[model samples]
Target: MEKNTILEQLRAAKAAHINWVQRAKMLISGFKMEEDAIPVNSTQCKFGQWFYSDAQRLNGLRNNPLDCMSEIEKLHFELHDIYLNIYKIYYDLEPQGFFSKLFGKKKKITDDSVKLAKEYFASMEEVSKKLVNEINLMERRIVALPDTDLETL
Candidate 1:
């Protein structure tokens, strides 16, 4: 694949990851109070799934440029676990009538969920930043390759 093609894919993944992180933060920030407002539901689960999906994509992109992909893949799995944990918590909260039980009519969340979301949010943000930085470095290397070297590929 062309270097730019790979970079573009990485860029798109990073963008999606950032969007999810922002939405998760909103959940913690109380901007989204209704269970429907949260991104963890079936039809609106993009933000929740982005953590796992982006990590996988990042691993594929890194294999061409990084020597130690195993470590990177481990990091991705860690993030995926965190995402799944958040999803699990939300799933449990649903049957309890979380919207009415927590905040009367306001649909407030449990303190525990807030705490977990914050922790995972910080972690996902850090990982996404690191992956984007690595992708940038790889792009620089690709661009600096001599024309003859490019032709050999």
Candidate 2:
């Protein structure tokens, strides 16, 4: 990929993550969204898709001593781990009786769980900030490389 193309993809991935955090905040704020809007798995999100697919092939992001890709992956997983806690708080995922499933019934989420979810959200936000920083650091490394290096990506 050309340097500009790679950079553009990076910007898109960053935006996806930022939008993801915003959507998560919106959910915590009591707005209803499509269930799939905020995926619980780190690897399921758009940013994760891009990071996993493109990071290894990108010149500066892989096979380098100063590579922070692993750190980025760790932080991304931590963010999702925190989100899983919040998701559990908002949903009663235990198996339901056949009748309940047939009727499309769900166990009601409790107010206490809502409060707990907020606490988890705060933790997720912290991890998200670190993830973004690592991504920025990776971007700087990419930009520092000569155009010749970028050409091979």
Candidate 3:
């Protein structure tokens, strides 16, 4: 939890989120990825893992919890919720056991479905921007603190 360490983790988390968004766009573009690769859960993705774990120690950044933390969490969850919609549009390949692959038809990728997924991604980008800004705000606030206080981190 050193100040610079926290800042680096924050930067990595933001990059992780950006990568996830790119994967979603790839899905919409028809290059479907496997489920294990890109997690769709709010609390399971890479950034989510960092947020709930390492970022928890970031709480008492000022003896008062960082307000930006809550905002980032909210936006993070919203971003995943939006991603769920996009996932369903493309990857809802319902498992009907072996027969699903043998007989079940792939869901036709409709123009409308792609359009909708792209729209969801657009929303995610906006949410991601806000999330990044809040993270930057937190970084700035922590950097502004005295090194003695940061040492306590």
Candidate 4:
């Protein structure tokens, strides 16, 4: 791809990463509120499951930009791995079903779940920052390259 095109894609990816970070923060806040609001008599709180769905949607938002950069740099691969890990963590914490719902057994949020969510959000924020930095560095490098070198690139 041309350097300009690559830079444009990187900018888009940076934007997506920023948006994802915001969504992740919102999810964290929502999760906390939901955890706090769970009634003693309630079973099968939908918060965890809702979070999973929302997280999946947020994950999807980056797919287009990420796909565009798949072959551009190793950093893209690292970002992909980080995204997958986040999804895996969320998946593991997905609410239990069937019997618990039927029996009115509360799907209590364990300390482990809270810890994992906090860690995952932090990792996601870090990764997003890294992506933005990488994009900025790439833009600077591209700007610094001579016309001949740019043509060759």
All candidates: TM-score: 0.54, 0.87, 0.87, 0.47
Among all windows of 10 consecutive residues in model 2, the one with the lowest summed lDDT is: 58-67
Q: Tell how far residue 72 is off in model 1, in angstroms.
A: 3.7
| Per-residue lDDT over 1-153 for candidate 2, one digit per residue giving the tens place of the 0 to 100 score | 677887889889999999999998888888875557998888799999998898668635345633688898889999988888877766556877888768866546678877887888899889999999998998888788777777766
Which parts of model 3 are misplaced by more than 4 Å? 93-105
Better by lDDT, candidate 4 or 2: 2
Q: What lDDT would each prediction earn against the true structure? A: 0.53, 0.81, 0.81, 0.46
Q: What is candidate 1's lDDT per residue for 1-153, written digit by digit as tens?
A: 455654565566556556665665676676644444435432234423543453234344332544333443454455555655655544444555665567654433589877887887788778756655654564575566443443323
lDDT of model 3, residue 91? 66
Error of 4 at 59 (Å): 27
RMSD of each: 6.3, 2.5, 2.4, 11.8
lDDT of 3: 0.81
Clashes by residue pair, model 3: none
Residues 40-148, model 3: lDDT tens digits: 8888889999999988876755675477888988999999889888878866546656876577546777899899989998998899889888888887887777766
Q: Write one digit per residue (lDDT tens) for candidate 4, span 28-122.
A: 55443232232111112232232233212322432223232222234444444554544444333467688865775544555676577677667
